[model samples]
Target: MEEFFKKYKIELEKEELEKFEKFLEIFKQKNSQINLSAIRDDNGIIEKHFVDSVMLNIFLDFLEIENPKVADLGTGGGFPLIPLAIVNPEVNFVGIDSVGKKLKAIDEFVEELELKNVKTLNGRAEEIGQNL
Candidate 1:
């Protein structure tokens, strides 16, 4: 897993790699039971979900804010939200999804990953946007 990230020129610590490993395990275990996503293969998840998600850090790394807060709309299976939160522990993340069951899986990911900088919200873009 670390090799994959390194191939993409994404640097990560040993602890962060461990979290990503556990996160993948949890995702696979839960996804089989709940059918949380259509992309199942390891490379698919890695290239599409994990690496692709963490790659967003390139943009965030330039942010000048003291504490950055990011939102991932339609965050099915936690996608970029989980990956980013793991890599960027200083940045706060809120993953919003309309599917309540999916959000439950994200909650599990958050707890299992022991991530302190992440949160999940159950709502749609328009509905949530109207309120905020």
Candidate 2:
């Protein structure tokens, strides 16, 4: 994972990097209990989930919003939202998923990672978006 970040020229603080490692550990453990992801191996998770999620940073310059508020609809297993929140702690992230079990697992992941800027909503995107 560190190599992946280095490949992209992204420097992560030690603490931040540890948090991502912890997230990956917890994700794998929970995934075994629930179908959080189909990619079971470390390399697959790193590339498909961690790297893929952090790819959102490429669009950050275009957003041009300080402390941007991001809503990830149908954010299964936290996906881009968790990784995005991890890298950009100042930004706010709201992850909405219809699967209650998945949301529960994400809640646990958020707590384990000690993420302060993320919140999960257990509801359909359409219904939740309408109310919001």
Screening candidate 2 with a backbone cut-off below 3 angstroms (N, C-alpha, C), the clashing residue pairs are none
Question: Please, what are the lDDT tens digits per residue for candidate 2 over residues 1-132?
Answer: 899877767778898899989988999999999999999999889878988888888897588997688999999988998998999899899999999999999889989999999999989998998898
lDDT of 2: 0.89
Model 2, C-alpha of 109: deviation from truth (Å): 0.5
Clashes of each: 0, 0
Q: Please write out the lDDT profile of model 1 over residues 53-96, one tens digit for every residue.
A: 99888899787788889999999888889999999899999999
Give the runs in model 2 whose Cα sits over 4 Å from its true position: none
